[model samples]
Target: MLADAEKNGPKPAPLIEAFRRTWGRMIIGIGAALLGVGGFFLMTTFIISYGTDELGIDKSVMLNATVIGSVVEIVVLVVAGRIADRIGAWTVCAIGGLVTMAVAFPAFWLVDTGKPALVYLGVGLGICALSIPYAPIGAVVSGMFPEAFRYSAVAMSYNLAGVVAGFVPLLATSLTGAANGASWGAALLLMVIAACTAAGSFASGSLMRRERAARPAGDRVEVAV
Candidate 1:
């Protein structure tokens, strides 16, 4: 029966129809990705420049700090992935976003202090916050749609977010300049991005439950990706 369905399943809905059916979750996923990945870009892609130019840290030191953060993030991604599996992806992601938002300003302050140890501590905190949600996002977003259109929905949302997030470094630069070289400007950007992710996480969880409830038991599919 499964093989027959694979060979003879109804053609996937048209693009517009797919979007109409799953727009709620797709929009939530896109918002979450835009903010989550935007925050990640602000921290990773732009942090070196921000630290060196705005905060007066050495360029080499900033580079080392980034490398250290990446290493720490690898560990965090694994742990967070495991935790998301046991508890729930959306729950973990929402918590991560709130924590990131809460720490954004303080993290920047630590970096602004120009002390090497404190700088590392601040950067590590930001990376950990982003990585926690980053781990399980693929699973959450891909699971939002039926199997027939899952790939298109997830890919479109993810890539759309990436396109916007690519500009984060430039936006952060402008924000910092607007604030007269104040790190708070950039920190504020991160806070907003984190808040979006947190809000989207909550919305996505609700939509997931509704989608499941609306489907007949036989039509429900457990998605791994």
Candidate 2:
């Protein structure tokens, strides 16, 4: 398998050309990655803090909620991937983004309600929404670039998202403090981030469709160079 892959691997020159051709779409994908991954980090970082400090919930209960939410996310990830395969990755991602955005305020509200069960439900729902975009995002980003540049483009975008994700926790915490322990600001920020991801997903999807339509019928399918 390794030998066969190497035989058909992309050439350097074509990889460069592929990057040049798809740079715009790549940018959109990177933007989506930043938001999607950052939002995930933001939620994970603050759920415990908010539950204990602001909502007066027990630490152990919050910890259990996080664990349960993670388990639900894993299951949702698989289901989301299967759905994306049937519909379209971008569509699934966009839908997920909308759901995440819609749920942000309510999730925060539920957490602030100071009910343990509601808090668990809110966290679980948020995780499910996060999984929707996440599951198919790998394929969606890779599809934005030609096969020749897929690896490089995907890696760069993903790493950039990681950088954003690393900071989101601190940022959310600061914002929450600034709002006098109110979670609405933090929730709003997440909603805005999710919106960016949704917009980017739609834009990248449109670009891919255009590229596909522009290809000549009899022309050789562009492989990895």
Candidate 3:
């Protein structure tokens, strides 16, 4: 099974085992993360096409969420990049989990505010929370194996994720329909995506953290690579 196989140790040849680790986790994590991200596009598409009725907002205000989210992504990317460079991927991922937990809570309150701009603020924070840990995930996947199989494993994961990315808009649309047939309602349904991310990612990060932490304290993470 994929789960059992993922938990297994590295092979005698580091490259082979590294291929196994990256193969199982990378495609799954990236696809899921993108799909979750694709939810933003979905929300925008729906709101742009459908309009925000429940919130009494104009189309221009709704677009601000994207603008704000872009800014948020920049902040997250810069900070996460530094952390990934310094602290190791797994620890960053774990910390991201805690940040996600805190971020998700505000979303619930933002919905009640009924101001589209405020909602955008909360959404921006959520996007930032989601993005900050992403740097480590890719690095972890890329470095899992020796040079031999790294290309194959990493490429396969990215390609598969690209394939899966196409399906996100459709799935997100369905989720919107299921959520009271309104675009804003989609936010509630989207939380499920976040929940799954926390579970699977925390698992991935925790596993890697344990593996990396087993090394001597003075041994730097880069040296482990």
lDDT of 1 by residue, 1-225 (tens): 457578898555646666877777777888777656888789877888888887788988777877888899999889989988887788778888888899999888888888989888888888878888888887777756776667778888898788878988999999999998898888998998888888888887776676677788998766422
Q: Superposing all C-alpha atoms, what RMSD in Å does each candidate have to the true structure?
A: 2.8, 4.4, 7.4
The worst-scoring run of ten residues by lDDT in candidate 3 lies at 31-40
**Poorest 10 consecutive residues of model 1 by lDDT?**
10-19
C-alpha positional error of residue 122 in candidate 2 after TM-score superposition, expressed in Å: 0.9
Return the clash pairs for model 3, or none: none
Tens-digit lDDT track for model 3 on 1-225?
A: 235447874435644664565656664455335423444454445434434554565767767876787787788878887877776664565566556656555753563365886768766776677676565657655544334456666666556655665555566567556765554445544455445455555555554555466657775355322
lDDT values for all models: 0.81, 0.78, 0.56
Point out the worst 10-residue segment of candidate 2 by lDDT. Answer: 216-225
Which ranges in model 3 have alpha carbons more than 4 Å from their true place? 1-56, 108-113, 182-185, 199-225
The candidate with the higher lDDT, 1 or 3, is 1
Candidate with the larger TM-score of 1 and 3? 1
Model 2 lDDT on a 0 to 1 scale = 0.78
What stretches of model 1 exceed 4 Å from their correct place? Answer: 1-14, 218-225
Taking the candidates one at a time, how many backbone clashes does each contain? 0, 0, 0
Which prediction has the highest TM-score against the true structure? 1
